[model samples]
Target: MAEDRKAIVPVWTLATGDVRAPALAGGEPMTAERLAELRGVLAVMADVPIATLEAHPLPDKLDRSRGIPLDAASPLAQHLSQFITQSTRSSLTAARATAMGENLYRMVVPAKVAAQFDKGFICSMAAKGTVGGIRGPLVTSTGRIAAGATFVPVGKAAAAGAAGGAGATAGVAAAGSAALTVAAPLVLMAVAVGVSAHADNKRQQAIEHITELLEQLHEQKLEEEHSALDGCRDAIDKATAILLDQGKLGVSLGLDSAVHAINTALGAADRRLARWQTALDKLPDDKPVEIGTLTKSFPGVDEHGGTFRAHLELAALAIALKRRVVVLQAVDHAQSDPGNPFENFTRALRRDQQRLDELESGIAGVLVRLSALELARQDGLMPVFTAGEVDRLMRAAHRIRRLGDGVTVNGRTTDVAIEIARNKDGSVVVFPALPMGA
Candidate 1:
């Protein structure tokens, strides 16, 4: 019999001032169309146990203690304390789940979309709270009902009953209205609490996401720094190797040997020039001297003696020219020579000097590149160079020039400079120059 009784369901409409249920079973004869509409409305209701006024216990009086001003000190403090209490009372697992959802949303959503979602969510919460406060519970029932019977708005139930051929009761409708008015504010309060919790969780998730991104960026920067450092070290090693190899060559055949050969040539030139000067002094000032006597075999004569013969001929012409060319030829012979003694020495000296210049230029180029790297680091264009790496590069550069030190090359110590000078007798002396600040 209970199942035979046509069930009356309620539908709560949000449209303004429309809170009535259709009649069912014995009201102004219900039409098939109206019944179908009523059924359609009920079809959307949540599938749950219908709560009746008699079956469910209602609070005797509203608890005003739960309403605002949690503390007597200050209104602000009271509000904050109530908020904190409510947040603490929320399910921790739910809050964590919500936080994870928010974090995921932030990671995937564009900033503009996320911001819009936040605004829309807040507006939705506000609307829900307002609607819950005004409309109360959407459904209520008043009769013996089966378990899991869905309920709808009181107005919808009455309208449905009327549509189903039932006469609507004014007393029941009034009671339902009163019950909804009382329940509305409480429902709205619950909604507000849930929304507030969601908002707080979203804010925390945003903070966590920002922190995660910052940490990732820091790690990336550290990796870049290490890469730049490795690059700098590799560059330094390559540059150092080049300088070391060049330095070995320099120590072997560079400044030291070139200077020694030049000095030796200068000494021989000085001796020949001295002999020519003596021969010129023996020639009569007014007579043409026989060139054969000057060409005759002389002690210490060699292939390199051509300069001496040229100087002698020049000196003889000087005797005829009244000693005018004496100092000219002597100075010219001292400065340079195209013969064996000085020519080979000049060529070797130039070659070594050019090599030294090239090596110095290469070293300078390496330093320029290094300096540019440092500048880039300083300007934040590249990763910073560590102090240890910089110091190591500097040390390597310093050692480059000294690569052949303590190592003999071609039976001679590579760390020597040749010195050339004239004695009081106009004879040239050549010796190794001492190292500076030795």
Candidate 2:
């Protein structure tokens, strides 16, 4: 049986992060729309600025500016701001899922392990025509095998026991339905580990998977693909009996490796995901904040480099805040997808959006402290922000001194406040919560 598996499964591996999902009939078709969406999602992850709204370029890119891109006169520009922001966030979420999926694919599920089950599954399907269950199918079969087997389109149950592969990629539902459909049905799921890059496991996924396979053979019904896998749990517990008794499972079956892969991959992915979070969800990092061991926020002066440290840090932060404002403004003007109820862009943004005043209040507070950096500027030292940026920051600074009344924070409030500025070194100054001083 183990030998049969080697030949049944393909020699696919995700170490390179390039995954060609198992071929569904139409040969894993990439429709123009899906391809475009994929490109836009990729661009968001790469930090590529959104360049155009014209369908000619394919997927709509996420613009950091969040404001107008080409001539504002174009009707689409006005209509597109909302679409851009919605797409921006959606693409980002998808990108994050993909990164995490790819990372785990590379670190956890070995090509051999995956091949073993797939191979076994293939052989079973060929001979008996089913898989009672497989590891990362981690997916609960959509429904039971009975005449009235029922399951929600989006299944919520995890397959019983047997939780092995930790870094395996899982799906978050299909890409909101693509115009092009693949032949064989497909499902994807993801899990985070120690660092949460979300290590969701109990009894290890292996334990969980094994448990499910056990159930399927007994009182449970197996998926069409799952039934042929090894065998029915005894007609009830047969597969489990075989797993331990007959030792039909391949080689070492390395249950321990799955846990290790989840841990290591999560740590690595945590760092990578942090970078993405800083640039996307939060303020962008123009540079890394490297003030000789100081936290992201430059703390108390440690004897030396007082004013000079303040000068550089403040300038960088000021530039970043200004850039943030520009993007926020774009988001403000952007519209929602009113036509497509399926996209749910409008409801999503409305549900998640912070009040405009509250959002701006964060910017406003940072603008005030950032003003001090302008005063610290030394002559001819190569200014941090550009001329155009300076003009915007300068104007924004005026509102702080005049119209900006002092902001007061209630000591008990836990509402999050964030302000970030970046230096050319790619280091950043991130200060969360209230504190305004120009």
Candidate 3:
């Protein structure tokens, strides 16, 4: 029996931030306490930007000219604004699923795995010609022997023998015995042929039965394929609707040039940070940027070097970018506007800064997600085989893995082979080969 084929499954997760900027004053002097606080915030926002968003849910909503609300702590507000931003993540995933159907799921399952499992079935069936019963015909002979028969016509055997005398009688007995011996073998031969023919017919019937079952299974697979295709179409429609909504949000929020602005801002910040460090470098070799060592809102001020001011500014920007990323991701919320026109190039300027923040924040989160995805991808397709049957699977997986060595994905070469492993509970596992140079 051929083993069921395996499929390549890619792991997928939502990308949280692609771009971001923390809330820091453009030309503010940094203090040891402020620098430490900024670093702490950036670190916290990396995994869950809930704190950052809660602190400054919407930067545009704030009075940018008035500067960051450094004093606004949890005591002032009952809840955090980050939660509001995070809520959008769920909305977007749902919307994506609704619009894309299998497309969205395909990202996680991968085209390979989907194809394999789509046609693969796990079941037990008898081999061909193994069903039904076989039997041979029974032979029997009715018995009675005639005695003292004569060859000549004499009305009856006993009378003929009597008239012919002893010689005639003996000849008549021999002739009767020869006749019975010849007829017995012929009867046995005919019975043997009949039994052989019956058994052949039964064997053929069993083969046909098995063939029919196989055909039915094939037809069932075809029906499923049709159903899955329909689902894909439905998903496309939903995705289109959501895309339109996102476009509208883009127009309303002025997100058209957000990406460009983000890049520009990051570039400027990078340059400013560089220059600030250069200035501090001229002061003395012994002096370094002493922002702080504390993990909380403040750091130790043991070494008082004026470089702390510059350090604070740099740290603050990192935090601010981190916050922006979270806000940007929030715009992707599917519920906000399914098919939002945000993708509309003409309306990029229409996207709000809040949306920009979400997108930027999403970048970082996406990086982490991507790393996890890659690891999951390495896990290859799942197994659906039992331990005892592992060695008996079809060679499809091995062939595919070998093909992968010479094949390229997205233009990158890999030497990964697919190895199928089975467990005792009738489960199958697929292991990807190590990359070349690994």
Best by TM-score: 1
lDDT of 1 by residue, 193-219 (tens): 222223332223323433433343444
**TM-scores of all candidate predictions against the true structure:** 0.18, 0.17, 0.17
Question: All models: lDDT?
Answer: 0.25, 0.23, 0.23
In candidate 1, how many Å is residue 226 off? 28
Q: What digit string (tens of lDDT, one per residue) describes model 2 on residues 1-438?
A: 011111110011111112223222121323323323433343233211111111111112211121111232222222222222232343432233222111111112222222211110111101122434321211011211111211111111111111121112222213332111111000001100110110111112223343444343342322322232212112212222222121243325432333233233333333433442343333323532222322223322222223223322222222222222222222222212212211132133333323322333443444333333221222345758667655644553453233223333211221111122222222222211111110
Ranking by lDDT: 1, 3, 2
Better of 1 and 2 by lDDT: 1
RMSD of 3: 42.6
Best by lDDT: 1
Candidate 1: regions farther than 4 A off: 1-119, 122-182, 218-438
Per-residue alpha-carbon lDDT of candidate 3 for residues 47-151, written as tens digits (9 for 90 to 100): 311111100001112112211111112110111112112223433422322231111010011122112211101111222454422121110000010011111
